[model samples]
Target chain A: MSRYHTSRSSSTTPVIILYDTPGHSPQPWAPNIWRIRFILNYKRLRYRTQWVEFQDIEATLRSIGAPPSSVRSDGRPVYTLPVIVDPTRNSSRPEIISGPSNIAEYMETFYPARPVFPEGSRAVQSLFVHYIQEVFAKPLLPIMVPLSAKGLPPRSQPPFSHSHAADALPPGPHRERAWQLVKEQFDFLSSILDKNVQDGDGVCVMGHSVSYADFALCSVLLWIENMAPHDGWARIREWNGGRWVRLREKCREYMDVY
Target chain B: MSRYHTSRSSSTTPVIILYDTPGHSPQPWAPNIWRIRFILNYKRLRYRTQWVEFQDIEATLRSIGAPPSSVRSDGRPVYTLPVIVDPTRNSSRPEIISGPSNIAEYMETFYPARPVFPEGSRAVQSLFVHYIQEVFAKPLLPIMVPLSAKGLPPRSQPPFSHSHAADALPPGPHRERAWQLVKEQFDFLSSILDKNVQDGDGVCVMGHSVSYADFALCSVLLWIENMAPHDGWARIREWNGGRWVRLREKCREYMDVY
Candidate 1:
């Protein structure tokens, strides 16, 4: 089944355009994009995905006049996917929001209901998101990046190939060491989530409700399941006494492809 | 002047006994104990401080049958302060709660009003508290530990002396590097708190209200101010556009000393 169906009619609510990268499957697979996708689905906003190839990201985003997400060390603007053009405010000239957190903040400002950052939790939630990105996702780059790059088209494989060559570890002691570091990070996160079990059965990063912190983590879990289903996903699904699996189950409602 | 007084009469509400270490001043300066003090003052719980010398911490806690906070590397029990004996549940044989987070959880459980972990935020709040303790406080030990040991009575200074000798950095490039790392951690935290400015002017770690996360951080600020008012506190108070000073001001009501 195609994952490109529109949620609402164009005459009523103008759909937001999400620039995403395509994967082997019909569903979107990028972790950062998944974060925004979770928010978009959770908010029940009318939106459509614009699949941009990895090579065409810079040109496509630049053509749309979307600002650079960050600056490169060598004084060049770095353009990445997961940029959104929201036409709800002004259907003629929509607002372009780049970066995952920036787009999440914009959505919170415009859609005010079913908030991702509930009850002024934007600050601490951002910290949690940052921790996942830095401490959790960073170590997995060696293992996941190469596995992820394998699925990309030949034309879109150059950018990731450089890091994949330098950082990728074969099945050996080094790979085991890499997995150990990732496990330690997971253990730290699991300890934090253990505190919430007393409140209820829900395994969200926040209180009992599903917030952006849960989405931030679940996005990575989705990435792992997509890239390394047999080895990575198999082991991670059972880690910390199946806490990650429970968390992913709790976030299953917001896992809509479109 | 003594910083030792009962909040409520012994007949009405049996006062909670807070085990704390003393500094040069009458006010209790230990960071972990200050966390409980903040919660107690915020909840308006009747409690009194029981000063314990560092040398007598193990014996004092063991005599009252308090459980060890943690196990040391060599398998012996590691006893620390911030142990509380709450008499509200049973006046004759009060319950002892050790460890900062444990005591905070106990307070949130029994005295649910004006909750420190508001709205089921125990999990994410624990992550924030853990970040402060590990990332923020760990680096400051080189600078703050020796300075703090100076304020302790000669009889209570042995335990800290070993670490002070090994970890204390002199006023040179080594100390500057340590401060730089500390500044980077603060910058990261300030960026997190910066998100809450959109909601209001409050400089809390969580929402507009002061939660346990703020107390966890402010407790460190109190330790720094008590130990290194001239240099360490002075520099930190001015960093991040005076955010720390603003946070301290917001927490002024709960820093009742008694």
Candidate 2:
């Protein structure tokens, strides 16, 4: 199968285009998109953001002839957000990589100087990212998605309802139950962060310098701050003995688009 | 409350006593205990092992006045295995550290030269261990426990059944269902390990040397290898391009008890 790449430009150094979800306002709420953005900024790679509306993700991906990074349990292709078109690296044609981990791997291979995996720590760091994406993010989904739905543009609301209606947290008391779950997950995370204070400089998630693992975590935190500040990040920023706050501060510079 | 330390002698450098669960044969199958054993050997710390049967766990712990590492969701204390009594490190009164993470922290604080939370990677390393213990190990419980029960001593079998009867994987098709869950978890792990080969030496889980993260993973691998070699470990040892076998070889030195 041919790989998908964006249309080329005049410059020798091809600019990479990042596709992100556009929320109620201008910023992106999805953690997966923020993950790629964090890596791009961290590696000092030049990139531009293309704000795709929620309802248009599948269509936009298919129109570009980009392959989905993964498939559903039943083997159906899952065309998700956070696909990137890195034109200069890999091939003469701009290379489009789908999914957060896939894009991170591509960036790491092409930009080895600005290392995210870090020496021999790749295996564990990958595991850390996997946990953040799969296990750590599970509880926050219920709380974050519904609150995020409130900020969605009217055009995007229908698809959000259609896709996530059953999975989204219900209003009223169930919200409290979901919050309880969120707290439980944070409590576990807090205990883990406490180890940093005891062992290291207590700043970044991995080593003194930032890595992909930190980006993976900070993305989740950013999602909370962006999508549901009152419902989630507000409480988390203060909890865990301000570990969350310090973590964001450590990675705060990378949040900026280059 | 006062901490419980194992009865000790007058040596200048005090020895630590590790509590582990003994299987039917002369081997340890519990991942949590294997975790501490790995740390003790990695640090080259002088320690002795005390094998406790499953039936005797509560009574033995209570007799020693050892505090349970954690409580259940309902708030009752959980008298689990893998507690360590470390002497001559922190206080004149030896410290009794319970649980894998707790003991690992004690070792790191005392033995900084042979580091587990390498450089400034404590937070990420801690999260990695947490995920292994909490998330990655969840699906294996059902598959491991019932199979492991067959290997437990005759005296230890009843209480193993009593305490874990409801949760143990049932006979026949339920066992198949458990194996299915186990395979799914391994598939996720194999993807993570594939990154190591792509990025680093593809042996250790974390940085160059075998750190605590490797121990955490190896502990699970060892549990499978010892508990149900044919049923569980055989399938995984070859999967993910032999990531598990290479991981075990990387940490093989630590598997030997002092």
Candidate 3:
């Protein structure tokens, strides 16, 4: 009940608890969790991250009674990270929403000003974000998991290793093949940005102003920066006329964690 | 030079020739071609369609020195339909642009008003259109080709049947499997639209108003309506809360041919 840290010296703004996955240390780098953080920062929501190790995510979510918004291919409810517990603005029960999109909709609904889904743009912006999650990020899993496992603490790395056991890559040639798949996806994304460049500033994914779509992209970029750095982000940052870097710059204001 | 039929009695307006493929009869049902037509109509440009049989597409394009905008997967130049010849607004040579996106960009550049991209929306809209073309439309190839062949004239049907010989479905079981694949894609699209509906008017693909993305979706919808209405559109039209029908209605004004 005392999850709310009401500091006597500071204003009585309710602090939202963002259940985030820890990277090498306790810092957050998980793409999905970063999506929520980006929105929180963009909307100036007061939130503190409660870091959860990879193996403890399900238990933590269960203890808090937060339900997942998605499921595994086998129909098991996927209890993943990026669950948020937000106390009502007025006096209402605290709300727990699991997925990034769900949390985003909650934010946009509750906090009407500083909107993310501007009028008429949500449909296409959602499609763009879905494509990034379902298609573009898929090919990066093989590369990302191994790199992330290396970056995470020794205690947290085992789960990633075991989880990727079946999807383990063959020694040399398979890594090349995996990177090729990532390159193909990157090339496709570049082409999409190239087309939009003629219409606007060529930096943001949505209209002239940045929206949730840009934040989604920035989350992926931040994941690569933290997990693989040179091996991953360096290889493709200059691609498609330096699109990844420009997109990162566009979302620079929201990338910070206070 | 006299391709311009300027009637002395009527208003002097140059007509653009849209080279389209003839479906079963003379109806134009190709999704890519429909994209260009949507933009032309959206811009209120005066245009006349010159229907060309599939067999004569290469020769017809070559005769007019029109270059294909895309290449086949085998690295061969792809001479596809949906080419447009727009006579200059002034005394410049007529420009022939092939491919839907190219023609759209050309229209926006020359026409310079009644915008489809809408400020800041082009990047995400372009990504949505690309996904429709590259990913969403891929699984439907087998089902669409067979049904479209049924609608084609006797002369055009043979080539389609021969080309799809390797990918031919079996009598009962394979057709069922193909429909399942189609259903899976439809389910994915429905989910995307459902998310967008929570954000805006549950109809158009982009912001509040219809844009090029909606046109892209309508193109595929029109293809299904003409090629396999009962089997294809009937099954998924009502999915995700009648999103397909609502989207179709959103772009109804652009669907008509003058």
Candidate 4:
């Protein structure tokens, strides 16, 4: 098989293998996937993605050595998804790059394109930080607590409705309550975006053009559109610059191989 | 006061910070304090430490239009922590550096003295990854279960026994169960460390010499000694790495200023 990377004449680009679990998941979360996809697209870099379902990451890593998972108390043993392997650096032995944040850092270090984050750009940096916190933590709502105790599927496994659970939950007291929390979160987020836009925050939060920070925030915004429409965040939904629309399109391009 | 890091520098010297809370919270679970302390000790690098106690970090950032805490479904907000602020890059506003893994990446990237983990060294990188997986995850164990329910501290406030938690966990089924679980974790850890030593993985997991990988592992090791003791981990107890010992001496040296 052809290597899943391209390069110029003098240099050989490393093969990038992304081990992902591509399901929409029970709870509808996939920030880890979009992060890698956007970075690769932003830099126009190529990589081969191998989708490893969530259950398999442990078995895959453990086939080599105990996944360092035996040390953890959790029965599931791993956290989150989208493990990446950067095979380009260190030609002798390819490095197994994992973790969502770690993979992004590796990309920034080895494959920097036009420099994504600005120097000491706290104003912009803080926004992406907030976006990460809100998006990842807010959505699952309170279903996880009740659901897990009752032996239902995890929120991340989504299609949350079971025959018994279906009647037990409504988007109102249970789901609706969670959605209300999310709606409030979106209100908080839109205010920040509005303030940044109002200030014209130099461009993309660093007083310049788009960097990784811009792409990172843009991806989170796309999630908000997909997940938090109940908040009626029409401002972000109808915003100009076509950033969100273009981002979703790019996400499709990233997903074509799947 | 002289700023520890005024701006990003072109050299490979990281701007380090020994993050702490007000009162210095005499507990082993203070992840940031131990991590940076461990890195500085392991690398034997000299830099300044900036203290932003819990209340102060909140007060300053909030006065700038940032929200102090965003509510999670748990009903309490998870506030962010100390960033390894670098002045040289990100436009001199101090890029937001959070997470132990991310901070390590920042150090290895900018201040790469003695080559942390060695570029493209798979064995070395894997060791570091293992260290992160085992040690970092260990620190999070307390937070994994409910504090009051499990007799551990709640997320929002430190345990009332913060002064004596390691020594004074009350005797009961819950406490015995927690201690038994902790002991089980230690047994597993001892087995792995024995493999490291017996397999002659040497000073580091990959071979002789403690790089950043060792630093990350050793920091957690130090945290654990403060947590509880077992007969098996005695070998690490007597470790006499002069640089590390010197760094701890320095921590002792700076005990009163804050």
Candidate 5:
């Protein structure tokens, strides 16, 4: 496994453990988890990855007393990965943070240098991230979720396959419509990026520097590249005048898998 | 009519004319037009209002040699209001700029002192505005369109009344569902604003300073208040812990009616 040492001067050992679920591929693939990974790498924080199987996610999170990320329809708690355990804050007791937003906030508070949210941009950046997930990514779920499930390891495949059975769109009009919706979202985002063309490459969402919004977007691109590199990534890379390809390249430095 | 003069030192007279449609109420009611009005007032640009009837919008625009904002499906050009004619750009030939985005950009380019897009924020701010219009204001359209049509002047009433006839949502479950969707959007926006609570009142979409995003949102709030004051604005003002009320108050300075 690849590891990154802390660049910051710290007397103690770097013990920030990021809990992630492994896919079939050697590299990490989940978009939500990739958000934190991007932030960790961007901040150049020293952290280690603890891979847990999808089946063991609940038990693993419960053992560490991390709160449930969400609740299922049946009123049961639904545990999710991308939880971080940071002993740097307190050596005796590591702070366990669940949920991507919470973890991001914790990291930003602890590691102030190279902030993910630039000056006075937390609210707007959060809105951008919300738009990416709720509007942009919502249309892609039916197409991507099933593809993503198929890319998981055999032990982790059963749960995702069963849960996302209804999410599969057969290769026909329905799937085409799904892809068309994804394209429209991409077009809208591309237009937003176009405004920044005068400044530079128009890769990062905010200004010239990389922010959480870029990480949030690039994480999805990474997911698409990881899961459906042949079809999905091929189409997306060419869309919006190759904006996504440039964005992925712009964010390539932070994609160090650990 | 209320008139605002330029605070800047200009030897020549202010000759910026904004084309807008007037409602039955003395105040301006159109949300799209309000966006420009907010910018003009915020920038403190000296401008005159040329009230255009809804039916006269096309003829008025055509008279000024302004291009059509869009084309109807039947191949006919569709003209819209909130077009600005600035003689300051050229003495012999005035520059007639249509569309809110274009007008805002023009204003920012010329009047760079008080920028609506604060430092490399043009792209993300535009995305915020897009989200407000395409997503947040969409469900409110079916509910607000018919109500807005009723509030227009008699000459302007016919076109809106007929055009939005099918957009009316009667008092029933469907209307309730529309409001619920609006509430959900408001909730999402409120959460974004909540991130700024520690900073201040959490009124502005950005930091403490008001920007174009605030104008876009406040324009919608003004629409609800103007069209459906009792039911729509009443409910919205109370929702999300009086967030909309605070935003409207925050932007009240820019709500000049001229």
Candidate 6:
């Protein structure tokens, strides 16, 4: 253990297992899982990643007693794409940690080196997360169902609808609207990025050093660059090249391998 | 002053200031702001809330020397409400924490009597935050924009469509799509809640106890319920009356006021 561990509770290390989706349909989300992996990588912790076939997610969840299938009538909405198991939290049964924020925080407890959040970045990071949720993620809904269909090949997820649910999926009329909204969303993000880039700040909103906001921003941005309809994500494209490139590079380097 | 100071960094009784936009006008996002205030109240922290006029946000941003009016070509983002000033992180300059997840974490740092994350809830919280951003918040976007100028006055201040100009307000054709998409989003959230409700955890996915996820979900749920077309927020409505009400109440009492 390093000096950061000097302040930790004990000498024992934690065991973490990540159950990730195998396909490229962006089951839960690529950037979402990537960021978790990045944080794990950043911690340099030894962990394991078990890629689950989307079809088998139900069985896998049931077998581990990690949010079994019977829990939902609609088959557990976006059911646990990234589930973590740690020995530290539950010595008796090996607790299962689900969700991205949970995984990141878990890593912070046992390992705090190369911090994702600065001493005072709690709010900044949280806002970034919210921005992604509210702005970035909002417009992505229409394409999600198509993305979740495992039968579709990666990049072959779904075609863009001119209006709501033009295709025969869920009959949910949010597709055309999502497409329309994503344009506005892209503009909003570009505007925000313009502020950050002009700020003379190294990365994101907080200025100088990159915080969790930077990482979280990076995740959404990666998705935007890949998915959104903004033909010229010019401002965002440049922003990504700056701090994001370095952040993800670090996340990859720091990813803990089980 | 409070027994909650786990970090032992400051002795001057940290202060948390919230910048709020009141009365559901300028946008009916009361639940988002309420969520932050509730946490502060529950943490038992004495904090001040200043209702912000959207027009004045840019001036405040400039005064604070944060990312200023430069956000747009000339003004601020349309509605960047809820600016938190926490003195604990940096003594000279306040930690500018905004957005819900960010604010919640900020609250946790100062008032952790009952942590938002359970024993080994680190990873789960991270994932929750990610999903909220990518999934939950994304779905809510459709209903947030008003149907027309008619809905603006009651919901927001004047110059509704032109306030920031950057938003190109009314969200245009996108708003209609967004509204239609609302049902689909609900369908997804309902599924998640349906499954989790049966898990019998009585807590969020992050831990054995209710974590920030609970608070965050309630805030969004309430927001969605308010924006929803009908009184059919069945799952969330039932939840609020059942268990969420109490958990939310506890979070409000965490008063670590400065």
How accurate is chain B of model 1, given as a TM-score from 0 to 1?
Answer: 0.93
Query: Model 1, range B99-208, lDDT digits (tens) per residue?
Result: 99899988888888888886767888888888789776888887887877878888887887776443567689988898898898888888888888777465987768
Per-residue alpha-carbon lDDT of candidate 1 for residues A96-199, written as tens digits (9 for 90 to 100): 99999999988998897998887778888888888789776888888888887876767888887676443556778998898888898998888888887767
Please give, for residues B92-158, the per-residue lDDT of candidate 4 as tens digits.
4655565555566556556667555443332223333443555435533552323322222333335
Point out the higher-scoring one by lDDT: 3 or 6: 3
Per-residue CA lDDT of model 2 for B1-258, tens digit only, reads: 012234434556668888887787676668888888887777777787888888888888878777898999999998888888876565568777777777788788877768876776777777777777777789887677777787788887875666664255655788888777877777787676667776457666654577888888888888888877877787887876787888888888777654
lDDT of 3 by residue, A80-110 (tens): 8789988746436788899898888889888
Q: Model 1: residues >4 Å from true position, as ranges?
A: A1-14, A164-177, B1-8, B11-14, B162-177
* Share of native interface contacts present in candidate 5: 0.63
Please give the TM-score of chain B in predicted model 6. Answer: 0.62
Q: Is candidate 2 or candidate 4 better by DockQ?
A: 2
TM-score of the first chain of model 4: 0.63
In model 6, the runs with Cα more than 4 Å from the true position are A1-14, A25-29, A68-78, A88-92, A143-183, A193-200, A223-258, B1-258
Docking class of 5: medium
TM-score of each: 0.91, 0.86, 0.89, 0.39, 0.90, 0.42
Which residue runs of candidate 3 sit more than 4 Å off their true CA positions? A1-13, A73-75, A90-92, A163-177, B1-13, B73-75, B90-92, B165-173
lDDT per residue as tens, model 3, B137-207:
88888888777767766666667666653354655988888878877877887677766665567776754
Task: Arrange candidates, best TM-score first.
Answer: 1, 5, 3, 2, 6, 4
Q: What is the interface RMSD of each candidate, in Å?
A: 1.5, 2.1, 2.0, 18.2, 1.8, 12.7
User: Worst ten-residue run, lDDT, model 3 chain A?
Assistant: A1-10
What DockQ do the predictions score, one after another? 0.68, 0.60, 0.64, 0.02, 0.60, 0.04
Native contact share for candidate 6 = 0.00
Worst 10 residues of 2 chain B by lDDT: B1-10
* lDDT computed for candidate 3: 0.78
Interface RMSD for candidate number 1? 1.5
iRMSD of prediction 3: 2.0
Per-residue C-alpha lDDT of model 4 across residues A115-224, encoded as one tens digit per residue = 44343222223234434454534564353333332332244334334334333244456666675665555454444333233223323433324555555655555444
